[model samples]
Target: MNSIRANPQAGLDIHMLDVQFIRDNLEAVKANCKNRNVTADVDRVVALDEQRRQILQQQQVHQHRQNEISKLIPKEKDKDKKQALIQEGRDLREKVAALENQVKEVEAELKTVLMTIPNMSHPDAPVGLTPADNKVISKVGEPKKFDFKPKDHVALAEALDIVDFEAGSSVAGQKFYFLKNEAVLLELALVQYAFGKLLEKGYTPIITPDVAKVDVLEGIGFMPRGPETQIYSLANTDLCLIATAEITLGGMHRDRIFDELDLPIKYVGMSHCFRTEAGAPGRDTRGLYRVHQFTKVEMFVFCTPDQSDGLHQELLAIEESIFQGLGLPYHVIDTCTGDLGGPAYRKFDIETWMPARGEAGEYGEVTSTSNCTDFQSRRLGIRFKSTKQKGTRFVHTLNGTAVAVSRALVAILENYQQADGSVVIPEALKRWVGRDVISRKGGISG
Candidate 1:
C-alpha cells in the first residue's frame, strides 16, 4: 500500500453555524455549546471573525488604490510622475497581499473554532450530561419470558455452527466474524426485509460505495482523521472506509441545488460499514454487539427546513415499524443534548431488548435518527431554490438506521431463542430466508 499524503486542509470548506449567526446570537450559541458539553472558544471565534473582516476590508481598499495608481501610470506624460505612480502601485499590491494572507490565517482559525461548536439543540430536547438523562418517549412490545436460561448470540451461534468467529479472526483480526449457514441467509433476509419496507415508503433504494473521500466525511460531520475517530482511513490515500451508509448517502448530492418542487428527497441505502471502534475500550466487545465491520441499511433525506422536523419524526416512525415487523421489543429515546454530537439538532434512538446482554437482559441501541437542520448541508453545499423565494437556502439533512445487521442479529438470536437450542426467524424475513427456524443440524423447518 503506497501511502500518498494529501493536504488534510485542502478540501475543508466547512461553513457551519453561519459566522453572522454566531455573532448576532452569541449568548445563545455559547449556551448551546455549554449544553452540548463542547469546549469551543466562542469569544475567540467572534474576535477572529472580526479580524478577518477588517483585514478583508483593508485588502479591498488597497486593491482599489492600486487600480487607481495603475490607471494614472499609463496616462502620465512625465516619466518621474509615472515612475512614482508605478512605485505606489507596487507598494499597494504588497500591502494587499499581506492583508489577504492575514485574512486567510484568521479565517482558518475561525473555522477551526467554529467546528468545535455543536448545532443548537431542539427546545424540547432534554439538557443532560449522560445517556441516563435521555428521555424515554415510548416502549413498544414486551420482552419475551424464557422458561430456559437464555443464551447470548455468541453461544447460540456456536451451538448452531452458524457464525465462524475463529475463521474470521484468522483471516482478518479481532472484532471480525463471518456468518455461515442460516446466519448468511438471515443477514440477506434482513436487508431485503428492510429495503422492502423503505421502498413502500417511497424511498429510492441504493447500494452505496463502502469508501469515501476524507472531505466527504468531514462535510458529513465525521472526524475522519483523529485520535478519537471511528472511521478507518485507507493506507496512503485520501479515502476512508465509511462508518455507515449515512456518509455516502449524504455526500451523494454534495454541492447540489434542488428546485422547491423537489423539496424532499429520501433514500434507503445499503452498504458495508467499517469502524475502528477506537477509544471504546472493554465495552460490548463480546460477540457482534460492537464490531469492526457490518452491513447496514441506512435512510437519508434532504429537505427544506420546514420539512425536516416532520421528516425526522417520519424517519423515527419508519425505524419503529421496521423493528416492529421483526417482533422485537424496543423503546424510543429522545437523546439528550450532550449526546447529540456536533451536527444533530435533535436525535432519537431505539434500543432493542437483548435477552443476553446482562445477568438477564438489557436494551441495546439498535437504531437512531437525527435532524441535522442545515448543519451538514451548509458544509456540503447542498442547497435548494424556491420559485417564490429569491436565493438558495441550505437543505436540512437527516439519517436513520433501518437495520445494523450485527446488532439486529444479536437481538434476534437472543430474543427468539427456543429452549431446544433453535432460533426462530421473524415472519417478515421468512420469504427471503426460505425458512421459519434454524436448528443445530443446520436444518430449516416450518
Candidate 2:
C-alpha cells in the first residue's frame, strides 16, 4: 500500500507533486495531464488531502482529551470516581484510534490518486499526441547509397552464421536469439566502445544488477506489475527483471543526501535489459530491432536542479559521439509531450539509419536521453544539501542510452553490408572485435 515511499528513512511525504502544489497549480497540472495523454482526477487528490487533514485534527483533539483523563484518573482518591475517569479515558482512546485509522486510510487513498498523476512536462517540449508530432532537431551523416541490394540485419546475420534465431527460440522462447561467431565479438566490442567513450567523459563505470525490487522499479517510474507493464516479475517475490540499467542506477542513491560539491554524479552502467515488448505484436518484430532481451550500456546522472539542463545536453552529446564514432548515420529528435515517459520532463532521441528498414531505408531510434528534473529523485528520496540552502532538496535525475547492443548491431550490420555478403566493423570497435570484417569464409578477418 506504500507505493511511493521507497526510502523509509527519508520521511518524504511528497511524491511527484505535493498536495499543496496541486492545489495551487490545479489548472496547469490538469492541462499537463491532458497534453501527456494521461488521465488523472486532480480535484480528487485535493479533496482527499483536505479529508485527511480534517481527520488528523479530530484525532489530535480526542488524543488530547484522553491524555487529560489519564492524568485525572491517577490523582483521584474516590474509588468510583477513579473508575469512572478510567472508563472515560478508555472511551476517548477508542475514538482517537478510530480517527487515526481513518487518517491512514485517507492517506493511502491520496497517495494512490497522486500516483496516477505524472511529472510536469518541460515548457519547451512540443505538445503533441504521437511520434509524428515530434520535432526533428538535426540530421547527421548521410545514409549510404548501396551499389547492390543490401540485406537486412536478419538476412545478413543468418547468412554470415553470426546469429542463430532457431536455437534461441528453442532455448528461451520467441523474440530471443543467440549471437554466434563474430556477432558475440561485436556485442562485446560495442559495450567496450561505449564504456571507453563514457570513461573519457569522467563517468564512473558500474555493472548493475539485472533484477531490482518492485518498489525500486516503481521509484524509477516503471510499472513492474500490470497488464500493460513491459516488465517481467518473478513469481512469489517482490523483485522484477530490470528493463534498463536506469532503474538500478536511479535506485542506487535512494534515501541518500549528498553534499552540494558532489552535485553531478555521473555513472555509466552495464546490464542485461529485459522487456516483454507488450502490445508490440508485429511491428519491427523481425531480427534484433525489437527483442525481449539485450545487453545495454546506460548513462545515469544525479545533479542539482540548475545543473540538470546542461547535463541532459551533455548526455545527448555523448550519445551522438558514440554513434558518430561507429560511423552510423543518425538524426536527433526532440520528443513531444505525449511521447515522453511519465518521469521525463524533456527527452531527446537519436535515430540511426538502418539500411533495410523500409523498401529503401529508414531511421530507427537507437538511443535516447531524458531530463527527469527531480521527478525520479522525489520518488526515490534522493536529495542534496547545499552550503547556501537551509535544507536538502531533491536532486534532478537523467538517463541516456550509451549503446543498446542489439539495435546497434542492427544498424552496423545493415549499414556496413557489402555486395560480397561481408559486413565491415566500425574502425572504433575494430581493436576490441579483433577484425576488420565478418564474412562466411574468413569468419572474422582483416
Off by over 4 Å in 2: 1-14, 63-89, 444-446
Candidate 1, 282-304: lDDT as tens digits: 98888999999999999999999
Worst 10 residues of 1 by lDDT: 1-10
Q: For candidate 1, what is the lDDT?
A: 0.89
Candidate 2 weakest lDDT stretch, 10 residues = 1-10
Q: lDDT per residue, candidate 2, 1-446, as tens digits?
A: 23233344644454766567889999999999999999999999999888877877777777778878877877899999999988888888788778767876887788778888888899999999899989999999999999998899999999999999999999998999999899999999999999999999999999999999988898888887667899999999999999999999999999899999987999999999999999889888789999999999999999999999999999999999999999999999999999997899999999999989999999999999999988888888889999998998989999999999999999999999999989998999999988888887875543
In model 1, residue pairs whose N, Cα or C atoms come closer than 3 Å (at least 3 residues apart or on different chains), thus clashing, are 3-236
Once fitted onto the true fold, the runs of candidate 1 whose alpha carbons sit more than 4 angstroms away are 1-14, 67-84, 443-446
Error of 2 at 303 (Å): 0.9
Candidate 1 TM-score over all chains jointly? 0.94
Global local distance difference test of model 2: 0.90
